[model samples]
Each structure stands twice: as C-alpha cells, then as structure tokens.
Target chain A: MDVETLALVQQLYGAQSHYIDEGHAREWAATFTPDGEFHSPSYPAPVAGTEALTKFAADFARQDGVTRHVLTNVHVTPAAGGLTVRAYLQIVRTLPGGPPELLRQTTITDDLVRHAGTWRIRRRTVRRDDMKENR
Target chain B: MDVETLALVQQLYGAQSHYIDEGHAREWAATFTPDGEFHSPSYPAPVAGTEALTKFAADFARQDGVTRHVLTNVHVTPAAGGLTVRAYLQIVRTLPGGPPELLRQTTITDDLVRHAGTWRIRRRTVRRDDMKENR
Candidate 1:
C-alpha cells in the first residue's frame, strides 16, 4: 500500500540532496510547495513562499567555499494531511588541498503533502546538534 | 506494502539508540544477527559476531559522561534477501552545567535481514563527518 509512497519520498530526498549539493537552488526550492517554509537556527525566522525561497537559495549559492550537504537516515510517517519526514543532515566544507571540515550537523523534519499526485515539502524544520540557545 | 518494512527499520534504529545510550550493551547487541558485523573508523577492524559485539558494547557503556545518540534521516531500501538502511547519527555529551557538546557526527549504513518474522542488522558501517584519514 505504501510502497509507492515510500518511493515518492525517496525521490523527494534524492532530488533535494542532488540539487542543493550541486547548487541548483531554484530547482531545490521547487521540491517544496509554493508556500513551503524552511526554518533553521541560522535564520532569524522561517523563510516562506517561493519568492523568499528564491532569494534564500540565491544567498546560499553566494556563500564562499565548497559545501556538500549530505542527507541520510530519512524516516517518513503518514500524517493527517500529508506525511512527516525526518532525517539527519551533515554539511562538509573544504578548501583546496584541505580535509573536509564538519560545518554543521542538523536533524531535519519535513511536512510533506501530495498535491496533484506529486509529493512536495510543506515545511522543513532544521534543528542543529550544537545549538547554544533554545528557541 | 512496504510500510511495515520501513517501520521495522525505524525500530532497528530506535532500539539501537535506546539500548546503547541507556547502557544496555547486551540488548543492543541482540538487535544484530548472530553473525552480524559492526564497523567504524574508531575500530581497528569490523567487530564480527555477537561475542565481539557484546564486548564492544560493554566497553562503550563504560565511557564516562551523559551521552545521547540521536539518530535521524533514515532511508531504507529493499535489497536482495534484506533491506539497506542508512541514516545520520549525532552523539551529544554533557557535563554538569556545561553545554551539550557534539561529540560525533556520523553517517550509518546498515544491512538488515528479516529472520523468523523479525528484522536484525547483518552488517553496519559508520562513516564520520570529520575524518582526517580515508579508510
């Protein structure tokens, strides 16, 4: 029954990892719903809507240094209006000839909804492992 | 159709985190098959079989500190004779009055098989985020 759902979920993660890691921010943002929310400790507040997401992706692409965001351990559970997905994310940053540094380790939880037979993230909350203050 | 399979995978991770964090070394080892193998950069070689796994867990449980092994982002895919599961793991350690420190961030991959109506890990691999040497 949920075989297809799980596959769809896999696609979501696959596309997300590929696009973001490869610096296709708009394409990565497109994996979310039009009004999807991306929240993290680095941000002052959640970035919402396609317009904001576009700008957010642009800013991310402008950051200095090479980064690879590795997403793993994706667990998806059916929810009332959609599905809840949780996974662990690690970002590695590197300079020329230098070993990769651990930039951030975060747990990401996403609320996904199937709209028009396509699964899209509705909200993504990122919780950093080394957060100093509670929000 | 695969809902239960994924849930069982989630259970494997949940049980692993709980048992290891709470110091139930033997119980944690039971999550693996009789001939299961656990490998990590920290280990000189793969810890093979239940006996070795038991000893490894025992030594881990003796470490001093309040530690939490937080597992997230679990992706489970069907494979020959079993399932391949991957996720991100973060270990947090805290001393009294000190901030929770990120001790380790690793990407874990486990090969699990269903035996006699139960799922058990066959081979588990750990890759750390900030390893200076490649193995």
Candidate 2:
C-alpha cells in the first residue's frame, strides 16, 4: 500500500461511518461501487448494488437513533483487480436520552476497487464475533 | 504506507495475537520493541519494556480461559521515525466447556518503529468502548 492508497482507504472508511451515522444515506451509498454488496447474518440475504444499499441506509436512518461504527486492526492485501481489507467493527448505539450501549461486534472484510481515482467498496461481508465460521 | 511496510505491520499484528493465544508468551513479547509500553484502564499503570510485557502475557495465560483478540479498521500514519497505528480491539472469552462471550471492546493505538528491518510496537494504549476519551 502506497501512502496515497492507504490514505484513500482510511478516508473512505471514516467517511462511510460519518455519513451513515449522521443520516447522510446518499453519501454513504456513494462510498460503495454501483454494484457493491453488503452482507450480515442479521439480514435475510445480501443487499446488492447502490440502490439497495441506499434503501438499507434509509431504513437504518429512519430508526432515528445514534450509532457509532468503530473499526480497528485493519489489514490490507492486494487482490486480482482490487484490494482486500479486513477489520473489526464495533457498533455502539444510543436511544433517546439513554447512554451508549454495545450493540454489535463483527469482523468486516471488504473488497475495494479503484474507480476514477477513488477507491470504493465492491463487497462487504460482516461476521459476528461469536460466529462459528473463521475469517 | 509502502506495500512492504503495510505487510510487515499486518504480519506483526497477526503474529502477536497467535503467539499469545497459543501460550507462546516469549514470542508474543518479541512482537514489541524492547521499550514497548502497554496501557489500559484495567491496569494500575502502563506495562513497559519487553520483560514486563512477558510477565503480563504470562498472567493472561494463567487465567486458563480461551481468549481471542480480534482487531479491525486499522489506520496507519507516518510519525517521527515510526508509524502510528490505530484500530478497534475486541476480546472474546470462553471458559472450559462454555460458549464464547464478548469480554471487552476497545480502541487501540500503537506506535511502531522499524528496528533492523522489522516493525515492532513501542507503545500501545487501549481505551475502553465506554470511556469518555475520544480516539
């Protein structure tokens, strides 16, 4: 990872969390490629493409709660036509007038590609901490 | 981050966890610089130096419980003669015959320096998820 590439990925990760947490669904969706996919055990199936991703973001925003997605221990590797990145994700949630609480802990692996000089997530899969499967 | 530097950091992160989890305390301590420091709210004071780090590792092993330190969302930045790395840390624990449970969620920042062509942590500070301090 060159300095530029590492910086780009760091910015993308930060912006995604900021946009979603701040209710900027469209911006959050834009962080992904047009055909990006998001998967989690909590969802019945994978959410594919920007349109669906935007819908998911909108739904999450409608809940009108505070969410902080903290990521750490990130590792990056070069892939066929893109890069593979893995990190731990910690989601803290707070309801109206309530203290923040630990909501979810998952390990996230993302496939990202450079498009028009910017890196965008092409696929993101999240596995819970207690999952039987290994990353 | 050059590719080589990134890979070296990633390998160091992975190896540290594997060594500690496998009861290889000495190997785990070797992941740090001779003067590395580990700090957390759980500790009365920072554990400094490789010798102290080995002692800490030994204490963790004596607990006789299974622990998995999962890291993610790592960000790396160049600093004075070293790199500053930050990431999320999730610790899962399991007792004999018991299922795994979420033990701790923390944000960790590490200062790593290259010594003899190898990257080693010189300082690692951990902040709990519920802490008032912002990473």
Candidate 3:
C-alpha cells in the first residue's frame, strides 16, 4: 500500500484500540466489517459478525482491569479483497490498586477491507510469541 | 502535521527501533542529530552528543538478551525549533533460553529536527509509568 493508505490503516488501529480500551464495546466491534472474523489464541474460539464481535469485546471490557493494545511495526500489503496488515501487539494492563504491567506481547495479522468509505477489519489472527517461559 | 509528514515521522520510529534492536549502535545513534540529547528514568544520567549516544546504545547492546523497542500511539506537534513527538514506549526483552516478556512501559517525548533533508531527534526524554510493581 502507498503512504496515504498506510496512514489510514494506522488510524484504523488507533481507533480500534481506543474504542476497546475505553470500554466502548460496540464502537470497537464496529472497527470490523459487518461480517468480520476474529481468530486469536487468546480466545477459546473464533468470533465473527457484528453481534458476536460486540459480545467478544464486551466480555473483555467487563474484566477487572484496564487493558491497552499497543500496535507497532505495522507492515501493509495489497491483496485481492483488501489489504494485509501485520503488526506487533503489546497488551498492557493495570488492575485495581495494582501497578501497570505488560500483560503479553503478540503479533496480529489482519485483513482490512474498506466498506462504505471506511476501513475495517475483515479478519484478524493473533499469535503469541514463542518463549521458554510464560511470564 | 499533515498526513505525509506524519508518515515520515512514523518511519523515523521504525528506523530508530530497528537499528538499536539489530545492534547497530552507531547507526542507531545517527538517528539523532550531532548534539542530540537522551534522558530517561531507565538510565542513571542523561546522555548527549554523538559520542555519548553511541556509547549509550553500545552499552545496552552488550547485554545478554535481545531487546525490542515497541513504539505506539505516536503524536506529533509542530514547534518553533522542531517537532515535538510523543509516543508510548514498550520495552520487550528475552534472555538466552528465556521467554520473551515485556520489560517495562514508558512514555517518550522527543524534539525532532530535519537536518540535511532527513529527520533526526534533537532531544528525547522517557518517563516510566507510575507502577506499584516493577515485575
């Protein structure tokens, strides 16, 4: 993708993370297309479509801590259907009366499609980094 | 700043992280101007100038593990002398035979200058998050 498109993709990420982090579940889910799919090792099963996506995000938001999704090192490529995006995702958390901590680091690969003049995720797969220890 | 300039600033972060992560200390130091300054809670003293910056990066490279600087949520503002850039800095590290983990998270603010047609850091200050726990 070109630089202008790259800038738009970056904004897509910023908006997605902001919505979820701020507990705006519906808005967060809207970051995806109507039939978007999410497949991640962190979840028990893949979630697809608007209703399911909303619930998935809402469940995470109901948790007892604040979580931030930090996306960096984004690389984008053009595809037949949309654009392929790969980025480093660092999840940071802070629980009640607890100090902020780095919860986990994962790589997120996404297929982003622009529908109705806006970019949204069509599919996303998150992979955890291989490590000798979990902590 | 405009979209194009924003794209350039993003490239600056990517290059800065890549050079240091790959152990190219001199090249990493060159990401800054000749009299650039770096201040961070992670370091005992502020380091300035090309010589000191190179040494600072080299010292970190001497460590046993591999470290990656993940920068996200970058914000840039135009200033009189240069551009003020701020971003979330997540430090992730992995030792030999150890799992990769998030070492720390901090906020980084930078003063960027265009010297000889390329962007370079004039000053960078990193601040740690207020955390009750440092693990």
Could you give candidate 2's per-residue lDDT for residues A27-130 as a string of tens digits? Answer: 99898899999988868999998899999988887875788887655656689999998776677889899988766566688999987679999999987644
Tens digits of per-residue lDDT for model 3, A1-135? 367787788788868888988889899899999999998876788999999999988888888788898778775767888888767777888998999876666667789888989788999988665432321
Error of 2 at B28 (Å): 6.3
Off by over 4 Å in 3: A1-4, A130-135, B11-67, B72-90, B94-135
DockQ of candidate 2 against the true complex:
0.21
Q: How do the candidates score on chain B by TM-score?
A: 0.92, 0.93, 0.91
Cα error, residue A72 of model 3, in Å, equals 3.4
Cα lDDT of all candidates, in order?
Answer: 0.77, 0.78, 0.81
lDDT of model number 3: 0.81
Query: Which regions in candidate 2 have their CA more than 4 angstroms from the true location?
Result: B1-30, B33-113, B122-135
lDDT of 3 at B123: 93
Q: Fraction of reference contacts reproduced per prediction?
A: 0.10, 0.16, 0.28
Residue B125's lDDT within candidate 1 is 92
Q: Per-residue lDDT of B1-84 in model 1, one digit per residue for the tens? A: 266666666567778888988888888889999999998986789999989988888888788777888775565667898888
TM-scores for the candidates = 0.64, 0.65, 0.61
Ordered by lDDT, highest first, the candidates read: 3, 2, 1
**Candidate 3: which pairs clash?**
none
Q: Give i-RMS (Å) per prediction.
A: 5.5, 5.3, 3.5
Candidate 1 per-residue C-alpha lDDT over A1-135 given as tens digits, one digit per residue, 9 for 90 to 100: 277788678756855764564467788888889999999987898999887887787777666554557777789998889999989878866544344567888999899998757899999999888885622
Best-to-worst order by TM-score is 2, 1, 3
